[model samples]
Target: MVLTADSYRVLRGWVNGLGYSLDARLIPYLELAGFGSATLTQTFDLQYDLISALVERWRPETHTFHLPCGECTITLEDVALHFGLPIDGDVITGVSVIAEPAVLCYSLLGASPDDTDSTFSKLKFTWLKANFQHLSVNATEEESVCPARVYIMHIIRGVLMPNLNNNKVHLQYLPLLADLHNVRSYSWGSAVLAMLYHELCRTTKPDAVDLGGCLVLLQLWALYRIPFLASVSHQPYVFLLVNRWSIYPGIGRLYTVLIYRLMIEQHTEEGFIWMSYRRPEIAAIIPSSSYVDSQLWCTNAPIISFNIVEWYHGDRVLQQFGYIQYIPDLPMPVGDVHGINKRGKHGQHWRVTHQIFVAVWENRMA
Candidate 1:
């Protein structure tokens, strides 16, 4: 079962794609394993057997990697280490190599509070900084367009929020945001803003000063330039679905339907949009004729009413009363629950309820 030259080429391509060197070192391993003179099928079988043996010996499945904030997951970091690849540079950042167990404990649990000089913690911090720095910005003159700003805000609020820490990282990026604003690099500025929001949301016990700072920053951004909802793009809608947060509840559900029509039904080709969850339930609520409604759900009271009455009422009651046991039916046009008003056609009720449902479903899936 001699291996074909074509099979060798395919293996070479795979190794190169993984950022591994292909040289005499690989040749010896291949020949020693009988891959140098085997059929394509035989070569695959031999490689599978070798990988299985390595997996058994290494027990990578048993090793759990810890994140900076106490999250743990099984990862291939052990396998990467066993393969003698560099674990700290572009390799780790690009591939998202799991953190070593010790580093995770120190970063998340504060195992050694006084030891600020630990190598693993330093490495993790450096990796974080580098990854954010590497995010590409669209530096065109139209980068500050309304659609673009909304897109950037969605990315900040939804995608990057969970993994960031607000207290430490938000203030660190003030200068960068200021510089980007000065240069009119709205895309870059938006990225920094998103990072700040991400950190802000992660704050476990936010104090008055923290809330004030966040408010002030947000006000400044709002006043810097007015962002309109003109020229709706797919990115913001996709981010909204993926992050499951909407500026307005009606608007979010409207966007969900819009995304289904444009991306799923019409088959409009785009990146990022493909990765988002398709909310058919939302789409079902929207009338088919209103598929191209330029005003979105602003004037669609019936649909908006359907959204509130059908979906959000029960959750709103539970949130107020802590359980569904001692609650009255939600009054027409929802009322205030903890400063978030649910009444009115365009009130916070829609927004909050929609967010609650999205978060609940997302967490359940997770």
Candidate 2:
């Protein structure tokens, strides 16, 4: 039987495979903001077929894969160990559309770009790259902070929390970066996973042509969890597990979309290393900070980013955490929550708009 358009998984790589280089002066600030472990020096293909296959297996209602072996997922532990990012603390939510985009940009970044397309709330990566690309060693502390913030903003828009805009990023996160000293406290890793989980759910809609929101993390998660799909050799483990495949030779283009779907559908529990992170060497590299909230990795809570809320049902995939893989109860009914987006949400703070989900996260482990 041939596949119809309705049954076919459309493949689309990141439309803009852009790269950015951070200035030496901004390193400390980025480190302070909890993204120092991540690097942007390399640009990567999204491994579209691989991502599409995973998305195809993703169950939106359950937020875990219904693979042949058993239910598994990219856990909060994976987000923490992979990126060395803070997983618990302040929620990264705010008004989706800033009422005064120029004011926020100038106040936080010390400059503003031209509002040519009325997309003022969404700044183009080109404008940011052109202006804040470089910072001098002699720059003042105040002078250095501006470019450093811009660099993190680029990471969010370009890499960590990408969206369909491809070349631009929403300014909702600017307020979060306004106070750099407090930035690291904002669970950047959890936010990345939330954005990714939502994207994985959306892509399963059968008509999604483009995938967004940290496809890199999704690919890396697949490589570690589904060893059969990966074709790389043993190498020294990297700190931010996200950086492990920076120099990887491609394994995606070797197979077609249907072939990849078949490989995943045929996987067995024996082929899966449920304890990949338990390796002593890898466990050693996971920073202590990532463990402060290690307990929350298994909490059935909502992982949230501004204007985006996705359920993180750690209780459902306990086997990934090395616990017994019991058959889970009926997956939580969150189909309505999955339908919500940032559209028509001007002047609304995500905390207020999405408080229902946020409350679930607030009382996590209750």
TM-score, per-candidate, Cα-based: 0.16, 0.87
Clashing pairs in 1: 1-39, 2-38, 3-38, 166-199, 334-343, 342-349
* lDDT string, candidate 1, 1-366, tens digits: 232222111110011011112222233333322222211111111121111111111111111111121111111111111111111111000111223434543333223223444332212323223222221355333322222222222222222221223212211122212222232221221122222222222221222112211222222221111111112332465455634635543444333334333332222222212111123653454333322222211110111111221111222222112233343333223223222212343323232455543233223213
Per-residue lDDT of candidate 2, residues 1-366 (tens digit)? 554445545567554443555666778888888878765424665667677777878888878887887778888888777677888886788776777788778788888896454447788888888888877658899989888887777777777777778788778878888878899878788898888888888877766888887887888888887777775323323113324322443322323455567767776456777878777877787767766778887787777887777877888888778788666666666556565876776767778877888787777767
Question: Total clashes, candidate 1?
Answer: 6
User: What overall lDDT goes with each candidate model?
Assistant: 0.23, 0.74
Q: What is the lDDT for 142 in model 1?
A: 31
- The window of 10 residues in a row where model 1 has the poorest summed lDDT is 10-19
What is the lDDT for 169 in model 1? 22
lDDT: worst 10-residue window of model 2: 233-242
